[model samples]
Target: MSWTVHVGTILHLLDPTANPRQCLDRLWEEVEKWTSIDGIWLQCLPGHLQPSGTVLVGRCPDNADEIANLASPATASLNTDGLPVVARQLRDGNVPVALILVSHHHQPQPAGFLVDALSRYLLDRLRLQLEASELAEENHYLRSSLTPQVMQHDILTVSGLMETVIRSAIRTAPSNATVLITGETGTGKELLARLVHSHSTRSHKPLVTVNAGALAAPLLESELFGHVKGAYTGADQDRKGLFEVADGGTIFLDEVGELSLEGQVRLLRVLQERTITRVGDHRCIPVDVRVIAATHRDLSREVAQGRFRQDLYFRLNVVSLTVPPLRQRTEDIPLLINHFLQKCNRENYKQVEDVPRKVLEILQAYPWPGNVRELENCVQKVVVLASGNTFHEDLIPPTIRSYINEPHPLEHMSLGSSHSQDSSIPQNPLDNLRQALEHYASNAGPNIGECFHHIERLLITHALNKERGVKLRAAKLLGINRVTLDRKLVEFDLDVKRGIGVIEPLVDASES
Candidate 1:
């Protein structure tokens, strides 16, 4: 039999008759060098030596000549001084006739028939190993290729609102325009910012990020525009600010609404002049960085309240992207849940194979206030706590589990309400409404019909406010036709446009 030995290749059979005990010890030591595994198992006949079990053997780069000499068909007991060899007997229905050698990630052993055929043993093992290696490489390639697809799957939604947001983000990604992403907290503002940076021309450069809300005004200033040595109390060394670090790339300013008035001014200067001055130094350094700001706060409202500057708001609002809250895109819940489940399995090493239908329904119904971030946490929790392969309601966190199968008042009026037809709004809203009516009645002294009108006016106003002053949507929430809504608007002296109503005392105009 001919056996070839070379560097970088695995599999080497030692002399047929080697000192079994010593050979086993050497083989184990050698295998340990290649991978971390439990002690080796030696299976062989009791009499004259027979090799068996599994052994790992990789050629050494430094000593190929020595290896060839050791492996030469010499009538020697497994040469302890040269290459390592192992001996063992295969279990019932399985025998190691051909010396099986493997590296760290070993391939499956060939069938017993294939192993016994001396002529084809080497070729078969080599072919199997090559195929296994190729399969492993292909698997790695597929995983890497699927990464971006998974990300897109997680974000892309069936809802038109989310599709519009994604389309807008794509349209703005390639441009050099400053982008301001607004949404509720945990709505993936930073994630969208990263998407913009990844698709932009500046993708090749760094995308430095800083949370404006995380740092104080002074520290934040230093972080934005690097300070020179000795600029402040502990300014030991000159530091390059985020803008400088992101000179040819994009700088993501997260929670930008949290910036102090002074911080806002400095940021404004960077936007307007394309330059930033170090804290201590008066030198204005030109920067070619693109600014991508994100916040959960309404900057327009902030500007109105004198908290945010109008000019800065306009500068950063060059291309505004509003990431829809998860509740608004409930249709994507199943996709996201599955995506997160796969992610949890990989990260937590838990094989939660499936999510139960009831669990999925509950997850979709619950309003994720923390948005995608909250949903991710929920999935992770369930995966970690799941006792079996399937995720169940019992595995969910208490807060989410409690809400499962429970109806909420807000679900009744919102356009993006849950789809469970059997779910009815809790009577809490009605109870609260009744309490308000009694309080108002004691003060106004109105009769039954007039009181009913006042209550209808209050409900309509509430719906209109919730619908952001959209008359048609408000009418839908009130279960009334648009004509009826318009008449109610006039009767209550409600200005739908202003989202407020002026009601003159409910006079019995019929008595008049």
Candidate 2:
């Protein structure tokens, strides 16, 4: 007589999505149906990582407990009472990973070899399911590790300051009141302006933008209030300004503090009367426009300094939104890093998908004076310069790396049971001096003169890089006067390259 079982029939018995216990239970029913099997079980062996020791699936339910005890890997090949045991070892290389145990109660069993072969095939099928399950688990772990927050209105942030700014923008968007947005130059004031306009009643109409500081003070008036034919040089035809263009919509005036006193008076009039008069024309053109102004300068201070109009400042400050700088909101840096990583990957035709934790720490410690825009530019440069998928410390500019790369004695200290948080801060001046003295003691000589030289050069170079090579700014950042900074610059032989102040790090030859 010929026994019968097909491959598809066996596959249907084992569900890959189910646990091994469920798979074995379903598989055993098929085995007992097609053969004269009394019992069958899978026994776990060493290195399987399977705490699921044995799965019994066949008949002999009355003596199931006794049979299961014998089915474990230690007693897998033992026959109990009148049953005979036939086993197949599942080997991963030379080591046994599992044992497929089968029991029967007939002499001269022809199906014994066939059952062993079937057990091996079933175990292989289980291996496939295990591999797939592991892959799914790994993907989920990766996604959880990557995202802690989501972007709202294309703005990704978790900081309370930023959330407050966004909430204010949303709450104030529906009104016609002029909004004054203030922040550092790169802190995304214009983005908040667009957010306000997009959620406003005037969203469907044109939204005009002008860089109030980026124009000549003489021409700024014509640019905002427009010019008629023959109003001035190059005024050959009738022209409408940004206010006219943005009528019935919203207009964003960036760097509004740069507006001249004359321009400020006209702006205040337009705010008060809802009308504008063209240059060389007296007729007031009524414009139903909402103005949103932004500035990196302190308008209140500008007003106090008498350079800006107080009335205009008050008119524009009906609603105010101040964006916090990135350094103040360091908690959001990780989310921003991943956001820019994926964005730069698509734009640069690169695949820098990995951002390790050390990179995050280094970036977090930085006082990003330039804010979000600088971070995005840093990430973009890193993506372009990346040689592989992972980001490395060397790819980051020396200006940023210097903050984290500095020598600190407290970094490795055990503190001898001190629990105070102050112990974890960077090495103090005295501690740093002691560390240098000890190091020099262990060296060939006392290079005290050279030690100070290394520090001065490194600091000057770092400051120049951080300030992007502006001499006055770098000197201010370093807490030194211009003459001292210039003298040091000459002494260190630090060349200030044109167009962005690139200064190479001056490494000591002895240290190298």
Candidate 3:
């Protein structure tokens, strides 16, 4: 087979997410499988300005010879003496990332093209592994730094009502009493649950969250009290419920108001007895767990109407905490906007440091019917499209822009601009891809591989832009998860390195 075909086959054979040592081993194995050759050796250069002495031996089997350091990278690339080896050094944005050395005992083998192809493949995978490690560390640091003070300062609130709620949460977190949190849909009832779990004695254990409202009666029973094999048609194996999984931990049952009468009886039995029986089994399993429930509805009123059982209501409402909606506390709007701005900046890799005064006024005036969640969406919109350190009137969504009397930018720019008259949102994904392709083809010539990679990068960019840099929404648009999208952004240097709509290849696809 031609070496180019081997290159493509190599990608399919190797795991892209493997670490340097693992990837190198897989590469060596694949190469050995496809070619009859003696053992091989590989080297990976240090990245992110790390030391040259720290350059890694990508893979050196216990029996393989150590001959990678015989010469410098430049000399190593051209060297052919001693072991009669083929070597290649590959770089990313000018920093050497890997060196490949494929050799055999005095025989002319699949030597030259294979070494170069392997070097390119190994380089990209190594960078991904290293970046993944670094990102993991960074994320852990960010998470660990979310102390109680920071959580309260950043997200809880500046309102006296919120302060009262937070104070109650703090005082009640250390106890085992059941907590019933009430609030509007987007007012962060889940956050309150987390705060309680983090401070309780069970903090080290799991916090299993269940949306009780989403499940039907039978499914809810089976989910809360797991089933044995053949409990139902779909019961293929024995399973554990969220409560059992959360043994010695806390279970946060969200939207408890929606649980049916039968589900309520099962839950009440668990709360009263601290035991659960599998759906098919009569044997009872004991558990030690704390319960935290949240609902947007008033459970008391439901009980008064006989829609909810008073006994279950009294069992769950031992302690109550309510979160006020954004409209009730307009003073917190600016603080929340800034808070979301910082968060989205880190996520989308933007540097928006300021919110314009007039824009803030318009945002504050809006009713924010969706509560803090909607306000956050609005902030994310402005931040992603800001293009600078401050916000502008044009960046605001039309829904929010409708609050004021000033002429919309679309109306003024309608004379010449091609943006939609109704909204600034981009067209459908297919249109975005077509326009991106046309733009890419107009600016530079790309091979099939490069063309495909460019299209992927553009779609990710367009999806992020369309969703206002909300990674989850953008991922939904691209049919990928947020983690996958993050990896793609880093892989292609699309995060901040290439600004929105810029079509430049950081590395050739064959090499990437």
Candidate with better lDDT, 1 vs 3: 3
Per-prediction TM-score, please?
0.54, 0.53, 0.50
Q: lDDT for model 2, on a 0 to 1 scale?
A: 0.65
Write the number of the candidate with greater TM-score, choosing between 2 and 3.
Answer: 2
Q: What is the C-alpha lDDT of each candidate?
A: 0.63, 0.65, 0.64
Q: Residue 65 of candidate 2: its Cα lDDT?
A: 24
Q: Comparing 1 and 2 by lDDT, which wins? A: 2
RMSD of each: 18.4, 17.5, 21.6
Distance (Å) between predicted and true CA of 396, model 1? 1.4
Best first by lDDT, ranked:
2, 3, 1
> Cα RMSD (Å) between model 1 and the true structure?
18.4
How do the residues 25-55 of candidate 2 rate in per-residue lDDT, one tens digit apiece?
5444444333233223322222222222222
**lDDT tens digits by residue: candidate 1, 1-512:** 24422112223334456554544445444443432222334333244433333343223323222223222122233322233333222111221122323222134233232223322433454654554455456435434444453457246445555667777888888999999999999877887888888888889999999998888976877888899999989999999988999999999999999989988888898888999888899999999999999999999999999999999999999999888777656656666776788899999889875655546556665667898889989889889988766676777788876654343343375431222221111111333465757855765575676667656766676665444344544555676666898898777666543212122322323344
Candidate 3 contains a number of clashing pairs equal to: 0
Give model 1's TM-score versus the native structure: 0.54
Lowest-sum lDDT 10-residue window in model 1: 419-428
